[model samples]
Target: MALDVGMFEGHRVNRAAAERRCATLTTRRSVKKAHQAAWLVNAVRCVDLTTLAGDDTEGRVKRLCAKARKPLASHIEAGLGLSAGELTVGAVCVYPTMVPHAVKALEGSNIPVASVATGFPAGLMPLHLRLEEIRWAVAQGAAEIDIVINRELALTRNWQGLHDEIAAMREACGDAHMKAILATGELETLNNVYSASMVAMQAGADFIKTSTGKESVNATLPVSLTMLRALRDYGMATGHRIGFKPAGGMKQAKEALAWQILMKEELGRDWLNPDLFRFGASSMLGDIERQLEHYVTGRYADSSRHALA
Candidate 1:
């Protein structure tokens, strides 16, 4: 009698062969679980100084820092808290002079202030003035600084100039978290965005942000996907983990979740934490709240009250 080779050759097989394949599958699953465990351990061990230092501050500064670190839901609850256990959201991003307003809005909540600097929308200012703007922002309690990269230099292939400007701005940021905006719309190409993303990371950007929100063209999925990939590659090559923020055009809960999904898919679960991801928007928080409310209440919110300004 001839052996039935057909059944044994593929996924379908005799009992004995299937048993052997089951053993292989079990071993592979065990190995994968072990690898994931190791990755999780390393991630837990990695310390984010920004987050750690945030815990030590005091007064309004401490509140803002904590609020900045809180998830979007927590921020909204603070505003609507009818009880004593709830605290307001603490961190906000605003124009240079608007730092005080953000600070006041977040008062008693202990949120830190963030300000956009260096002729933010255009970034067409002298180096000294930009540095001064950063200093002034920090002096006014801006714990986070978002600076726009000069698009002309980036577009003209002036990598070194762009790098130096970012480095200078980083220094001027002092201890504040420095988010370098690529202004993706102006870059106008995936290749440019990728190259600029690498330049920003290599030049000392604590976070490589997608856009300034002032431009007509704002952050998009393709541009964000490209930037995240560049950061992941850069991290692998240099062993320095970089953060990503897709700012502008993020207006709805679905949009925020889409960016979150993109980050998780592109950068892995290790980057899913707040330390590695942020959504830069003046209007997203309210949408996130409304969605959360709808999830719980099964109805859209009567009014959307969350606004950065």
Candidate 2:
């Protein structure tokens, strides 16, 4: 697949309509009691439990990996009739320099170590350096590389430049899966989001991410809807299924339910798995674990009780 301006050049997203649809999405659909617990469990499996901070340390990454390996508390898993080692997060995401620690920590757990590379959050570094960073992370045993796109390229409508850059990064990723962060908040419009998404997928992005978790605005329902539309369109045209990740600013169990509902409705149940969708959040897991505990015990646990994630 190659870049095709015709696919998204003239595309327009109706913000109000998207907002309206999202507004009613939660209110109209209700998964109560057991069904709600099931959805929350599924969300846990698809979460990319992340830790990306300026002061990140190897100990912190290992702790996060330990959580990923055993996400649900023993009592909660037993209450739900889930076996030991049955449930785990999709991956443990961390800074590139911490990939080795994560890899060692998650060994034999079947959980992939995902590292954010390519000048993550800003992506302002030189192109060559960015590609090399991706390569280095893969060599460090990262199974997944989350690379941020240059927002300047998207803002200026340089789709060709954007596609070439992402394509090169994808090449540098070798066999590791690449999630291209669109940084949609800085792109200024849903039109740019759609176009950038198309270009990223055309360039062989395994997934199109909504943000770097560093933008002022990140992972809104309207923006996710726009990206999902592009993903669907790309799949229809190229017969390739691409994944989606919405990172940042999502910190509640309800938000996880909302996004999962959106995914099921828009892309069907097929997209509800870890391979097709992921929530990139660190604190959100605490909320989800609390909710699961409440479901099992009919009482909410303190947030600190599930703070390991």
Determine which window of 10 residues in candidate 1 has minimal summed lDDT: 44-53
Best by lDDT: 2
- In model 2, pairs of residues that clash are none
Q: Candidate 2 clash total?
A: 0
Off by over 4 Å in 2: none
- lDDT value for model 1: 0.63
lDDT of 1 by residue, 174-261 (tens): 8999989899999866667877878887778899988887779898776776677678777877788988877776666556545555
Residue-level error in angstroms, candidate 1, position 301: 2.7
Q: Distance from true position, residue 172, model 2, in Å?
A: 0.3
Give every collision pair in model 1: 63-110, 63-111, 64-90, 64-110, 64-111, 64-112, 65-112, 67-90, 90-111
Per-model TM-score, in order, reads: 0.71, 0.99
The local distance difference test score of model 2 is: 0.93
